[model samples]
Target: MADITTTELRQRLQAGETPHLIDVREPWENEEASIPTAQNIPLGSLPEKLDDLDAWKDEEVIVHCKSGSRSSQAKAYLTQQGFSNVRNLLGGFTEYSAG
Candidate 1:
């Protein structure tokens, strides 16, 4: 797994690149604020939702949570599951929101 800073991700999105973005935050947290294009799958449910991500297995997936911690775990999990190109959004949504 690799690390992608919030600025980099934001810049990519602004450039109209639709990289796969997965939000590992819970429902309520997502309701507060989230990347509009990110798919929400809360960290706890990720294991059960593996099939839902199968299509992205070979794609560049960017995982994020409120802070970087949860997303790091998510990135590791996805990498173990054979996701070849997974990245943790460094500083996660907190940094994105702040910027």
Candidate 2:
């Protein structure tokens, strides 16, 4: 799937659509600023947490990080692991919070 812009995500949430969002930043980074509904699973821990995300395998799972880099990696990993609908948040939280 193509990456989603923060604006698009904001619009979806404003429209009352609840999408599954994953924040792949560090615990400290997540604590600093985070979307309450987004689950924080630090990038390094993703391997161990694969089972926790199997439920969302075929679902639209949005992954993000401080910038777009880490989430990009997360998206790639998830996609290779059989997740068909994973999307990286364009610009990550940096863009999301900017708006």
Candidate 3:
């Protein structure tokens, strides 16, 4: 497991890097706010949706949630499930939106 700061993530997104961005927050939270291009995969459903993310197995996957905590858990879970590359967006959407 690894981590990327909000600054780095923003730069990557701006550069058109296509990382598999996973929003692990709940649907309502996502509806209120979200980073552009993020795919909602609420933390609770990630286990059942592994097949949907298979195409991103070889690519870098960046997970994020409301305040970064959930995203950390999501990243660990994905890594344990054999994901080769996973990163938690440090400070998550709250910080991203603020900055």
Candidate 4:
């Protein structure tokens, strides 16, 4: 899997590139602090949500969590499930928000 830094993501957003973003944090965590455009799909539910993401099979998808741990697992899992363009947001939302 590959990694996407917050700077790169921010630049993309500024450039009007609406890439698919999945927040792999829990509902509570997402509600507390989130990228408004990111879709909420907790890590635990990813297994059952594969079909829901079928449309993004060949699309670029960025996954993030509070930190990077959960999203790393999500990226690995998605790649195994035939997602060719999945990336883990380095340092996740924590670093994204900090900067």
Candidate 5:
């Protein structure tokens, strides 16, 4: 999986790209803060939620959590499941929020 830094992701969004963002954080964490465009699917529930992301299978999908760890796992799983353009958000939401 590729690592997408917060600044790069922000620039891409600013450029009008609608990349698919998957939040692997827990629902409560997401409720506290999240990117408005991201789809919430807690890490534990990702396997079951795979079908929901099928539409984005061929597109660039950026996975993130509170930190980067969970997002890495999510990226691996998605790639194993044949997702062609899965990326892990570097430093995850923490960095994004900080920026």
Candidate 6:
């Protein structure tokens, strides 16, 4: 899996680059705030919800969580599940907020 910094990802989104953005954080954390185009899919539920992300299998799926850890795991898992393109949002949402 590739890794993209928050700033780079933000710029891409702002510039009309629409990647398959998935937020692997919990619902409550997401309710607080999230990147505009991000879809919610909590980490714990990802295995069961894999089909929901099937459309993105061939496309690059950007994953994020509160920090970078969970998102990294998510990226790895998704890749192992046959997702060809996965990128971890380095530093995740927390870094996004910091910037």
Which model scores highest in TM-score?
Answer: 2
Model 6 scores a C-alpha lDDT of: 0.91
Residues 1-79, candidate 1: write the lDDT tens digits.
5589989998999999999999999999999988969999999999999998999999999999999899899998999
lDDT of 4 at 47: 96
Q: TM-score of the candidate numbered 3?
A: 0.94
Root mean square deviation (Cα) for candidate 4: 0.9
Q: How close is candidate 6 to the true structure, as a TM-score?
A: 0.95
Going through the candidates in the order shown, the clash numbers are 0, 0, 0, 0, 0, 0
- Residue 94 alpha-carbon offset, candidate 1, angstroms: 0.5
Candidate with more favorable, higher lDDT: 4 or 5 = 4
Superposed Cα deviation of residue 35, candidate 2 (Å): 1.6
Arrange candidates by TM-score, highest first: which order? 2, 1, 4, 6, 3, 5
**Candidate 5, lDDT over the whole model:** 0.92
TM-score, structure 1 vs. true: 0.96
Candidate 4, residue 55: the lDDT equals 97
Tens-digit lDDT string for candidate 5 (10-53):
99888988889999999999999998699999999999998888
Clashing pairs in 6: none
Residue range with the least summed lDDT across 10 consecutive positions in model 2? 29-38
List candidate 6 stretches off by more than 4 Å.
Answer: none
Clashing pairs in 3: none
lDDT of each: 0.92, 0.94, 0.91, 0.94, 0.92, 0.91
Off by over 4 Å in 2: none
RMSD of each: 0.8, 0.7, 1.0, 0.9, 1.0, 0.9
Q: What is the TM-score of each candidate against the true structure?
A: 0.96, 0.97, 0.94, 0.96, 0.94, 0.95
